[model samples]
Target: METAVASAASTGRAQTSRSRCRMSPKRYEAKLRLAEAFVRLVEAMPAERITVNMIAEASGKHRKTFYYHFADKEQLVVWLFRYDLASGLADKFPEDLLVREQDSPDNPLAEFPFYARRIEESGRIYNAPFFAALSYSLEKRRAYYRRIFSTRGPGTLDFYLHQLFFPAIKEDILFLIDREIGRQSAVERKALRERMTSNAGVDFLAEFYTGAFLSRFVERLNYTSARRTARDIIPFENVVHDSLAALIRQEIEKAAREPGSEDRPGKGGAPCASPA
Candidate 1:
């Protein structure tokens, strides 16, 4: 759900089990300790200033131990996202990082491509415990946002988050597509990777999704009526589910239809058209 963290982590690879999706209970706890310590440090110091030693000291673990759990601080932060979001779910969530779910409490992150896949594959994961877990996890993230981005903008917070989640959703869609098509051949996979990395067929679709969900998240976050909580997101559960499934399906179809380059990376920071 952390935008910066997600972009950094999206090397276009799925997280291996040893990281968190599948880890010994003890290992999960150890990593969680580091994650919590990092969050705690953020409460006092900027994330940029915090170092491995500081995080290790806070977790009461040695420095080398951090490397065992994570390849680098960025990777650790990636798990921090999963750890914080999933812990509240109490093992009811999937093995990877909980995404888009962060914004609307019911939203998706690559969170959705995989999330939509799961909901269709299994009915058990759609139970109340799942939402309950989200309630706790998202609130935790909200508090973190409040403190960390105090000066950023309550007004534009939704927009900023929308921007972040869109990429995750977009990349996740690509990741899913890669699973289906990229593995067919090494060359095809490279082309797929290069293709998806650019903002082609799926950019606007991701934008629509992130906007819809994140706006709802912002509204609930600042509702100012009967303090917002996880339950607030329950009514929208089915809407979110159907929306994600549809969005992903549409995107993949579009990509399949147009297998040529649509846009490149260096747009020279072209500005969006100004409002009239």
Candidate 2:
């Protein structure tokens, strides 16, 4: 009788442990689906318009199940921003040299096209709701930076990382739009030409308009001039093709090196999916 009782207790403990192990993967997968669905939904509409029911319906999960995983919509948005956006940014900045490369004058604006393509691809897979969610997430990120570093000196590393670098990337996109699409319009073309040709106008415009748009943050961050090396300027098309090809090769190598469904905890205990 004593041996049977001990055996039963051991079996129960093993079963409980196995059950928990099984549940962890299920929960992780559910969260992944939720994040993907949320991105789709936001692309279609603004984050404010998204509700628990919408997420549940899009993910094909019940509202109760979503509530079980996330406390509310705000929490879900926070998780997605911290895990998805931050991780993507980290992946792009794989090396310190990559950061410097971004600031190099010779580097073509091909990266912006890659991001635009990513957005379009996500839209096709999900919905407009995802883009709307991303916009709100970006706004929140900006507000967070403003609150944290509003009064502090601008020359800090934190200031550059949180304030200047990220916003500069966004501004670069706007710059590309001005150069490409905005120039095509006759009214904009004439105004831009007038503004550029005026005495000290280009510098003034760069300072006020281009620089001023992010002056609040840029004023605080340390500005370092890129090294005066003879950097090669690859054509935008070639750069895109090469960079993407390299990325694919790297991914293949990474998969061969690490092949398993290991639960790697990302920012905020979120499971980080391996690159496909």
Candidate 3:
């Protein structure tokens, strides 16, 4: 009896491990499709106005399928933004950035084999996880990030951030911000221990810009949704980018002039601190 129980327990653990494996190609494609669909829906309507049923319809997937992948709509928002920051969307696609750029696109080659991109050339992005990630074909690549850059409509980071402040997803945004700040604090603490140049200013700068952009964005959304006379909030995007960059440069220099901030950096690498 004891021997039989041990064998069963070992078999169950093996099955559990296999079930948790995220390396499957199927899961990757499915998740990408769902994410793409969510981007489309949120672009046309505020995130708070979207529903699981709507997302399912947009994705052409069954309602139950969504639950199998995520607990709720809020999970999808968090997952998308987390993926955005992690995948270097904020860095690679900064044309839509509301304030300033701080990061860059992650290199897919770092994880995949050298031939991984070649495998993607089978003329179908969905052929492999690597192609969806590493393909240079902009049209084909749209499956992953085509919608991320429009400040006006689709994949606009402004829309993404603007919707977060709405009541519908307030808790979700709070959870994400808390987690991000926690991660930043951990990184800063780790850098302090190692005596390295810490990116301590990143979190503060991100907070400053996010707060600034959202305040204006909230007014835009409110005015539009109410059918009021609309003035474009960010008519000239390059101008906004340049203006914000200059403002930060001014402020950082001003801060450094303060008595205790002599050691603080007056400017960062790149106009936005990409470090290269």
- Model 2 ranges off by over 4 Å: 1-27, 89-276
lDDT of 3 by residue, 57-136 (tens): 88999998888876676556444544433243223322221111112232211121111111123221111222222222
Ranking by TM-score: 1, 3, 2
How well does each candidate superpose onto the true structure, as a TM-score? 0.48, 0.27, 0.30
Residue pairs clashing, model 3: none
Per-residue accuracy of model 2 over 1-276 as CA lDDT, tens digit each? 122122222321111011111213354688768867876776666665789899999999999989887767655643444444333433432222121112223221112111211223212111122223323334444433333233333432222323323333333333332333232445334433232233342233223332332352233222222311112221332232233234333432342234331222111111112255
Candidate 2, residue 12: the lDDT equals 13
The best candidate by lDDT is 1
**Global lDDT of each model?**
0.49, 0.37, 0.37
RMSD to the true structure for each prediction, in A, is: 10.6, 24.8, 16.7
The runs of at least 3 residues in candidate 1 whose Cα sits more than 4 Å from the true structure, single-residue gaps closed, are 1-24, 86-90, 93-135, 148-202, 214-226, 241-276
Name the candidate, 2 or 3, with the larger TM-score value.
Answer: 3
Question: How big is the positional error of residue 49 in model 2, measured in Å on the Cα after superposition?
Answer: 1.9
Give the count of colliding residue pairs in each prediction. Answer: 4, 19, 0
User: Alpha-carbon error at 174 in model 3, in Å?
Assistant: 25
